[model samples]
Target: MTPITTFFRNLEAKCCASCGQVISEQAESYATECYTCQDQASTDAYKHYYKKN
Candidate 1:
């Protein structure tokens, strides 16, 4: 692959917040969560932190 390709690939890659999976840079910049993480978060209520009584 060309250096430009590598650079763009690197530039476009991002790590997931929960699973540490590499996501798109656009997703990372535009969103706080990735696809997988967002899906999981939506289904898993326990994943969120609760306040103490």
Candidate 2:
């Protein structure tokens, strides 16, 4: 399947590519990583999951 970009409403949910966490529409616009996952990550280094702060 194609990579998830924008979130969809009234439809199926999406998962984070890094941590498998559920991605919410209100939490973001594009889909690749969830807020929690992204919060602990840098834009360039997102290959793995890590707690940054």
Candidate 3:
């Protein structure tokens, strides 16, 4: 089976907009939120799911 890790590797070098630390794209969206500064982005996935209904 293909490891999901490979797909996530590229996002590792992404620096957090709030914390300035490397955060994966996936993690940036879900686990985003600045680790050092403040909120990075919106955690809209949860709202989007219910909003579609």
Candidate 4:
């Protein structure tokens, strides 16, 4: 593959919020219970607290 093509392919892809894992390129939907959806700030705060413990 060309350098430009390879660069784009290596680019970070969309991901799921609940798991923080990457979603497939063909993924139809892109939202979880919170975070990436409605309760984004709250989800982030929870994750922060959970990680700090």
Cα lDDT tens digits for candidate 3, 1-53: 65878666754566755566775455537554445444223345556777999
- Per-residue CA lDDT of candidate 1, range 1-53, in tens? 57966665666456776777777655327675679788877767554544332
Model 2, residue 29: what's the lDDT?
A: 59
**Comparing 1 and 3 on TM-score, the stronger one:** 1
Candidate 1 pairs with clashing backbones: none
- Residue pairs with clashing backbones, model 4: none
- What ordering of candidates by TM-score runs from best to worst? 2, 1, 3, 4
Q: Indicate the TM-score of model 3.
A: 0.30
Model 3 clashing-pair count: 0
Q: Candidate 2 residues 1-53, lDDT tens each?
A: 54455333435667899999888665445668888877777654654444453
Number of the top lDDT candidate: 2
- Candidate 4 lDDT, 1-53, residue by residue in tens: 57976776666776666666665544335444334444667787899999999
lDDT of each: 0.66, 0.67, 0.56, 0.62
Model 4 — which ten-residue stretch has the worst lDDT? 26-35
Error of 3 at 40 (Å): 12
| Every model's TM-score | 0.45, 0.46, 0.30, 0.29
lDDT of 4 at 20: 66
Worst 10 residues of 1 by lDDT: 44-53
What lDDT is reached at residue 34 by model 4? 32
- How many clashes in each candidate? 0, 0, 0, 0
